[model samples]
Target chain A: DAGVTQSPTHLIKTRGQHVTLRCSPISGHKSVSWYQQVLGQGPQFIFQYYEKEERGRGNFPDRFSARQFPNYSSELNVNALLLGDSALYLCASSQGRTQYFGPGTRLLVL
Target chain B: GQQVMQIPQYQHVQEGEDFTTYCNSSTTLSNIQWYKQRPGGHPVFLIQLVKSGEVKKQKRLTFQFGEAKKNSSLHITATQTTDVGTYFCAGHGDNNDMRFGAGTRLTVKP
Candidate 1:
């Protein structure tokens, strides 16, 4: 079966702009989580959704938000982007407790 | 808030040498997960340790969970160039919120 898939392999945005990243979970998976990975650092959890409901959230600012759809697909939206927001955004899907990650969307803010 | 810290921010070893990375969490974890991320790539799950003091091995890699469930370790035996990457440990707390360590980047000289 195909693994998790993300859209818009990359993006370039300016400060104060908004961007949306999309993720499609693996088939039969009901949990999707979003993470932000800065250069030379591990991923930081942003939000997690299970069965189309908000399950958990991390210490990210209000500018970052995410939601899962009925089909288990997820979208991460960041508003008023700052240069600090430039990083890789990854989406992961879990069936039980183990998660499978996507290729991730690289975002750059100027 | 739960925090996960990894030691030895970076490691460089000659081929066939052994390497180990340690992870500690401020709070007891429900489970710990290991992931490998190649340069410019996304994280891929390696293994998950749910029970305290559990040990699991895969090929040249061995993973151990501490008896207190607040620390873990990943050891690579006879490191190969293929093992060059950043290894991350993520801790899941009782709320199911996951926090990832800064990661240990491994470089193997072939």
Candidate 2:
């Protein structure tokens, strides 16, 4: 079976620009979560959506937002990007338990 | 917001040596999950611990969750070249948010 899929494997943008990363969860999965992983560090949770509703959020700022589609796909949008935003954006899909991750989008803000 | 702390930040070991990483949570967790990510790769699920004081073994890897649900550990026996990666511990709090610790990067030297 296919696992979670993320789009735009790599992206580059200037400071203050906006970026959007997409993710398609595995078939039959209903939960999608976003995470940010800086170089040499683990991923930090950003947002989680289940059944098209925001179920959880991390310590990130309002500039970070996400949505879940009816098909259990997800999109992570970051506005007013800063240099510190350079990191890998990961998407994870889960059912009752066990979260499967996508390859992630590497976003670099110059 | 919940916090998961892991240590030490990095480890280097001989190919045949053993290694261990510990994870601690600021608050009690409902479940703890472990993931491994190779350099420049995505985090992959390795195992999950739910019950208090639970222990699970997979091949040469052993996972343990503390009785208080506030800590966890991953131990590897006879590390191999394939074991070179970052190990992360994620904790799911009562609010359903999963927080990941700053992972421990492991390097195996042949």
Candidate 3:
């Protein structure tokens, strides 16, 4: 089966702009989580949704938000972005167990 | 609270040399997972160790979980150039929110 998929493999945006990244989980997966990985650092969790509900959130600020659809797809939104927000945003799906990650959206904020 | 940490930020090995990376947690973890991310590529899940003191092997790679459930290790025997990548160990606590370590970058030179 196809693995988790993300959209806009790469993008460039200026500071203070808004960006949205999309992810489609693997077949039969119910939970979707978001993570941000800066250069030379491990990924940091941002949010997690299960069954269209916010199950958990990380240490990110209010500028970042995410929502999962009933179909299990997810979108991550960043408003008034900053240069520090430039990173690889990863999406992962799981069934209350091991998580499978997507290819990720590489966002570069200039 | 950052829970997971990996030692030796980077490791360089001659092809056919052995290499190892360590992960430690400040608190006990219910399960731990490993992933490998090639340069400019997305992370790919390698293995998951659930039980304490569990040991699993795949080809030249061996993974071990400590009895305290607060440490883990990955060792590669006779490494090949294909093994070049960053190895990350992530831990899931009781709430299922995953926290990842900084990762150990491995370079295998021919």
The Cα error of candidate 2 at residue A64, in Å, is 1.1
C-alpha TM-score for every candidate: 0.98, 0.97, 0.97
Ranking by TM-score: 1, 3, 2
Error of 3 at A29 (Å): 0.5
lDDT of 2 at A21: 97
Pairs of residues clashing in candidate 2: none
Better of 1 and 2 by DockQ: 2
Give the per-residue lDDT digits (tens) of candidate 3, residues B17-109. 999999999999888899999999878889999999999999999999999999999999999999999999999754557899999999999
Whole-structure CA lDDT of model 3: 0.94
Model 2 TM-score relative to the real fold:
0.97
Provide the fnat value for model 2, as a fraction from 0 to 1.
0.89
Name the candidate, 1 or 3, with the larger TM-score value. Answer: 1
Query: Distance (Å) between predicted and true CA of B63, model 1?
Result: 0.5
iRMS (Å) per candidate:
1.0, 0.9, 1.2
Candidate 3, residue B48: the lDDT equals: 94
DockQ of 3: 0.72
Q: Report the C-alpha lDDT of model 1 over A7-71, residue by residue, as the tens digit.
A: 99999999999999999999999999999999999998888999989898888899998888888
Error of 1 at B110 (Å): 0.9
Best by DockQ: 2
